[model samples]
Target: MPALRTIPSKAGADPLPSPPREVEPRPATGHLAKAVRRNLTAHGFLIGAVLCFAVFSWYPMIREFLLAFQKTESGRSTWVGFDNFRTVANDPAFWQAWGNTVLYTAFALVLGFAVPFVTALVINEFRHAQGYLRLLVYLPVMLPPVASVLLFKYLYDPGYGLLNELFDLVGLPAQQWLQDPDISLLAVVIASTWMNMGGATLIYLAALQSIPGELYEAAELDGAGLLRKIWHVTVPQTRLVLSLMLLMQVIATMQVFVEPFLLTGGAGPEGSTTTVVYLIYQYAFSFNNYGAAAALGLMLLVLLAGFSAAYVKLSRTEDE
Candidate 1:
């Protein structure tokens, strides 16, 4: 009475395969939520920086632009259109300030631009005490600018000054540093060069170090003198750095303020040291002509911006 089972024959087809198991797909919501959180955190940091820039930098520039066209009087601001610009243009000091600023920039290019590169060259040749020499050169920059200027003020005194004493020892006539209009700007330029050249020297030194030693060796093999090596190998190798520094120096010197302001009492003898920025200061603070001040500032901003654009374009073209 039991049920009988039969096995498949050897030549028969194989038995059917078992059904495959079903697997559940994972949900993507968790991954999406994590991505959202990450984005939010990144955006939160960016928002803070953007807000700060908007409030501090962008707002001030916008306000200055508006102020350039408005006259403020009796605690009230009124639309003045081009009146501010016209007023500034008509002032006699305008031309003189521009002239002096140009002169200052010229002097700076002659001394400040060259001295740093020369210092860097000298420092690079030294095999010992290089760090000490660099520290010594940069010591003035580390000191408070006001303190350094005051120290120079004492040194530049016509009487009982170290400089005058040195001149006396050399049998040279005592000379006025800040009092004489003819040389006051030159004196300021010298002080500025001394104060600022340390940074440029370091920059040049870094650039010089990056140049390949093999090029220098090849020059030496070719019987190149020191000056010849500099002209052929050094100058071309650091041309980009030199050009950039030149542009920066010109821009900075054009905006000369602190040196002449402190050393020469802002105008020096016969308005010889009066610069564009100083004129702006005179407009805003001395004369209380805010509109004119803003106008002049706007002019300076436009000029520098345009020059920067042109310079950058030229550089790119040359590179290409």
Candidate 2:
């Protein structure tokens, strides 16, 4: 018993070691097969859309060029070269339409462009009721364009319109809004702005929100008031969006048809509201001159392309 007590003993035995896990390498062919399947699935999903575009968009665009240069007589088609274009250019209505289009675009820039920007700025600065205000601003756009135009047409009636009534109540003379040639285009622009401003306003509001609050804070420290802060902090911050919206507004105004069309029978008093697109419509439907219509379309397409190119060049130059 004395000898056993003198021996040292271990407190615990060591645990057995666990076996290592075996890992299998993935086959290279498996990855390639997965990618192939993914691509095939994607293409399968896209086939319908691709077919639709080819049939509806691309094919018609190709046909427009063909129709622009071809004439049909006695159930036969023949090449007309530039004759269709010449006819379009020679028509007195063509130049008048161009003039009207340009004038409308100018007015649209003033009302459609500026009003929405201002509205967005005002709405964005609100600490409360922003959603309600924006919704109100955008409410007219929710109406169908035709409905909006017709509604404005009624509202612009000289004898019994609400606008005239309001003017009378305010001690201003009731004016012929859409009947007078001088103000018809202006009236159409106003109605178009009322109907269309919502989208642009929302876009501008979104752009305004993305601006850093620090910029306004910095401007304030520099004694900038509302106008100064807007000029220095807001416009500069949102210049890119402003430029884009400006271009979009120009294009949209250039194509204005429904408002002027519905409001003034596609041409205001003395053809004041007749735009290029309306002219094209007249050529195709009103007059049944398909070749001339296509030619006008081609001319419009060229002008828009030139304008877009010049705009891009000028904008880039200014940015540089």
Candidate 3:
């Protein structure tokens, strides 16, 4: 009773022995440790890649944009805002170049897209000499650009060109190929198509091979004719590849420079063959107007971006 008199009440006293202390979580080891290490390594690699991309790709793009807004005087750059853009917009040649570029793109796409797909389809359907045909089609793609363009230049020569010679033999009027400003671009397109179609043909051939043979066999058994089978089976099968190739061709055609440069000697007669890219070259290198060149480059970027967005939308719609 005496000891109890000094003792705290049950409610006030520690109702139970002190709760056991929680054990601190030990550092991970073995597999857990290995997993953590692997994660950190992967994160480090990703960070390094991001840094490289920022330094090499993003930084240059930003620099180019900034340069477009700057004017240079005797190696000193001064901020000029939209002045360059205004100048470019006011230039008549810009519109001409843009029109020419659009025309070239259209011609290239129609010729390039159709010819390659047809060639690929024909090659894929062949039972023999397929290898030789494939090789022959692809041979042009392997030639150096300079050599190919030069070869075309000779073929397109106005007076003694093979084309004119053939026209003479056939008693038809010998129209100027590269000499006439009106038809020079079309002539160049033909040459470019010949050289460029080889790669596209090979790509389409590969895509065609990937289609299931059963689809064709089934179509054949159902009394589907060749054209019907292609429309019902082949086209549907290679639609994605065809769409992707079309997009690529549009982009490539938009940036065309070498063919016009080499074949027509940089824009050709009366600037009829001058493309947007060639105009940019004239601004930057020919005239040394860096600001204007930058503006033109930005314009090209915008145009290409629009084209790319449209292509993506069309592709998505197709997928849906």
Candidate 2: Cα lDDT at 79: 98
User: What tens-digit string does per-residue lDDT give for candidate 3 at 1-320?
Assistant: 35545766788866666889999886667768778787997889999999999999999778779889999889999999999999999999999999999999999988988999999988998999999999999999999999998888788777788888899999998888888999999998999999889989999999999999999999999999999999999999888888888889988999999889998887799998999899989988888888999888898988889989988988788678
Per-candidate clashes come to 0, 0, 0
lDDT of 3 at 112: 84
The lDDT of model 2 is 0.90
State residue 119's C-alpha deviation in candidate 1, in Å. Answer: 0.3
Q: lDDT per residue, candidate 2, 1-320, as tens digits?
A: 46555444454556567898898988999998998887997888799889999999898877778889998666677999999999999999989999999999999999999999999988987999998998899899898887787788789989999999999999999989988999999999999889999999999999999998998998899999999998888988899999999888888888888889889998889999999999999988988888888888888878888989999999989989
Off by over 4 Å in 2: 1-33
Task: Order the numbered candidates by TM-score, best leading.
Answer: 1, 2, 3
Best by TM-score: 1
313, model 1: CA deviation in Å?
1.6
Q: Which clashing pairs does model 3 show?
A: none
| Segments in model 1 whose C-alpha atoms lie over 4 Å from true places | 1-45
